[model samples]
Target: MTTSLMHTSQQNQPLISWRWLSLALLVLCIIAFASASTSWLRISPDRQLQISQLQYFLNVGISYCSWLVIAVFANWMRLRIPLFSEKHPKWLLIHCSVAALISLLHILFDTFMLGLLFSFDFNFVSAFAKKVAFWLPVEMVAYLACVVSLSLLEQHKKNLKLPESEQSYTFEQGNQVRVVDRQDIEYIEAYDNYVFVHCANERLMLKQSLSSLAAKLPDEFCRVHRSYLVNLMAVECFESHSDGQAFSRLKSGKCVPVSRRRKMAVKSSLAALHTHIH
Candidate 1:
């Protein structure tokens, strides 16, 4: 599982990098369009088009630099705590607060750059207070949209790779090479540096980490514990404990302990299987 996870992660590195680049380009396009429209209306008709264009570009260029910084920070935060999958209400509040702060920083940075470029004098406190009222909502919406779009794109990519995930897995034991269908596996148990693959009335030891194996296994096989992976199809029943823990009883009558953290997932998988049957 670890190897497969690492491999998937490695494959996604380029995609992630491309996303950042695409985001920057998208921001640039938005700024350019806004700048052009605003300049056309505000600048005097007698003024040179090049001069108006240059002014607009400079203003947007300074703002874009600030936006780039904010984007990098937001992207980093998204990677660590993805907003799309976040279920806690507190995280929503935190993200809103962060978005407000980002907007404030963007205005401040733009103001600094504009002041340095064209010797303009204004009260910083009043300007910041005024801009916050106008820009906060806009920035918040943009941030949320960006996050949602990226999340959807990621989901689409994963769906596209589902067929690849369904391919059979190969395991080697000494001189014998065994090709196993993912559906035939009942459960897998981790022991030291090796994992025991339990299939129909036979158990085979493979010199691989459970995590690495789990990554390659089909979606039907779920990690119920740090040391065990249970085939949801093979799970005939679940045994619950008073301590909020659970165990999955396989078709072979072997019970696999489900960790506290995985109890809900195990239950959900079982429920899904039951639903599909009906």
Candidate 2:
């Protein structure tokens, strides 16, 4: 149930949705119509006579409409492979190839759409293909921007959902409740009914069970064992044994045991942080 909740939270992180896309599509339509209406002001009478009103709309606003389609792919791509990590090289190669392909397809699509606008004959409208150099670079920038925008939006959503004040604990300190920031904690240990939050230069006891506490914290706080949950950011190194047990040594000079059941998960979480693959 906790895993599913985390997965749902991730799904909601992306700001892109049907409502936003619908608004954008409406804006694109308005722009296309506005541009089509003002052709007389922008083009010379002779130039205006050369192309139909439909062709003029396609030439001016097709890229905007194309963006709506690209946004969907951007959301999918960003979710499939993280953009900012060790997978960066692979992401770049894929984006470059995909961007170039999209450029070519977009141009062809424009040319074909223009040709089929007035008649069934699709033998003409090579004019879009003529401006390949101009459109290719634009498409490259636009594609990258689309993906990056989604990534930034997701990060921003996470920040909003977990503001500094929300990412804290008000645990009992003697008789009073003492608030502590999650980032200040290096690691946590399950102390029977309560857990010990090992913070910077001090240890605070939270009157919460480890399992319940684990569900409340961020993904960075990985459960390494039944009794130990080490913050992946604080994990300096990991040592494994042939017998299946392992240990995560924190930067604060404390070694936390990694149970055999959760060993693979702990290793994977650390690897994702680029801490250690071994």
Candidate 3:
């Protein structure tokens, strides 16, 4: 290839990267810092400012930081698990457990720890958890929805079915084989340890774990279940099973089951995209 062509190919390589998450979190941190220092939120329950103002902002800032840390950690953990872009059972378990643990810690710190240390009666722990619970899941769900929607769009593009809004990992050794998307992707099927990516237009076999490929996939493909990652844009119809199994029927005429747990999420993602259209 000519230098210009080679440069263009390099530039056209997928722009999917998570380094932006850090930048986003930093911006949020700055916002929290600024918001905390402002006089908007009062120091105490009372409107009259009787006590010194230092404590209020300090507590708010601390709470914001704590929540931000929890969020970042949760996303990192979710991304770390190799589940082929699907939500892993262990991921959910860990998320709930860690979130609970953090809740307890936040409670202890804000309630007994802070109150006892400062001689204040505020049950900050309970208050903090309550507020955090209210907001955290919503944010997480929104991000997940975005990722799913984008993945679906990518799948559609691959099949030449639709033009989409194109807003779109490391390893070791031969065991950590890097996928050359052009040569290796005929179709992808998700099982437990591996998502079989058929190359050579379905005559060749290259098996890689779903989690690994998911990390490499552009936004147009998504894990619809533990066992299936389908291109949502290529999805022709979604079917319901009499046995309570939900499945997405793809343009390839392939029917893949959507796990019970992921059904709601898949539907929610589709709904979001539909809303975005109008």
Candidate 4:
């Protein structure tokens, strides 16, 4: 390739070799390693005695390096087919198709590279052959996780560009800006970039993630579920099931699920709200 052609090609190349990308990925890997080390009980016991710390780190480093390309591809895929679109069925199909394809490709590529580097026989096919069933689910889960995590980061960036108010929420809808009072909201349900705001008798939509919206809201709002943010003032009662599941029932008779992990927090919040009211 000529000099000008080489320069053009470099400009079009992927971000794998970028210094900032490397540093960010390294930090992510370090955090992952530390978390895994601390949560050893969750790890497979059989693999613990078999793999040395040095060997484990080397393998993790290699996996993460290759995952950088996959991550870039995931981000590209997400932008091409946004998380929330008008055609819900079509959107769901496309995401599933892409995720499956990526998972298979990642499994094959990662297996081949690992075999080439570590295995004596270098038989890539046999390495992940019988384990396709085993590895496919793991890779598919990883791919889905990657896509959702990327969406959060992408949403965070979009939030930074938008202006905020202390007492109300403002969201731009094309040329129109919709501002909703914080006190008027009964609850907020998350749907990717779109949030459905439920009032006493009507529901409205806003173009913002629940996380960003929750951050700006006052203490009256309580996150009862991953997808739900309930106004403490609107809650009629809190229900705790014997099966360990819990729910927040709003005065409007709407029941929002409270995740098992957040049950205690939800109980405490409700008790505090009740005490304050009394």
Q: Which 10 consecutive positions of candidate 2 have the poorest summed lDDT?
A: 1-10
Better of 1 and 2 by lDDT: 2
Q: Write the per-residue lDDT of candidate 3 for residues 145-199, one digit (tens) a residue.
A: 4444544554454445322222211112243433233323334576554455533
Q: In model 4, which runs have C-alpha deviations exceeding 4 angstroms?
A: 1-167
Flag the better candidate by TM-score, 1 or 2.
Answer: 1
Model 2: what TM-score? 0.46
lDDT of each: 0.66, 0.68, 0.50, 0.64
Residue pairs with backbone overlap in model 1:
1-211, 1-212, 1-213, 1-215, 2-211, 2-212
- In terms of lDDT, which candidate is strongest? 2
lDDT of 2 by residue, 1-278 (tens): 01111111122222446577768787878888777668745757575363577577776677766666566666655555557446455877787677778777888778777666645554453566565767888887888898888667645543454544556656555555566666678888887777777888777665667887776676678888889888888888999988876899888888999888776667655655562222
For TM-score, the strongest prediction is 1
Error of 3 at 11 (Å): 12
Q: Give the deviation of candidate 3 from the true structure as CA RMSD.
A: 12.2
The estimated TM-scores of all candidates read 0.46, 0.46, 0.42, 0.39
| For model 4, the run of ten residues with the poorest summed lDDT | 1-10
Candidate 3 residues lying further than 4 Å off, grouped into runs, are 1-66, 69-112, 118-187, 191-194, 198-204, 241-243, 275-278
Q: Model 2: runs farther than 4 Å from truth?
A: 1-18, 30-51, 84-89, 117-128, 149-164, 168-278
List of clashing residue pairs for candidate 3: 84-210, 84-211, 107-125, 150-219, 151-219, 151-220, 151-221, 154-220, 155-220
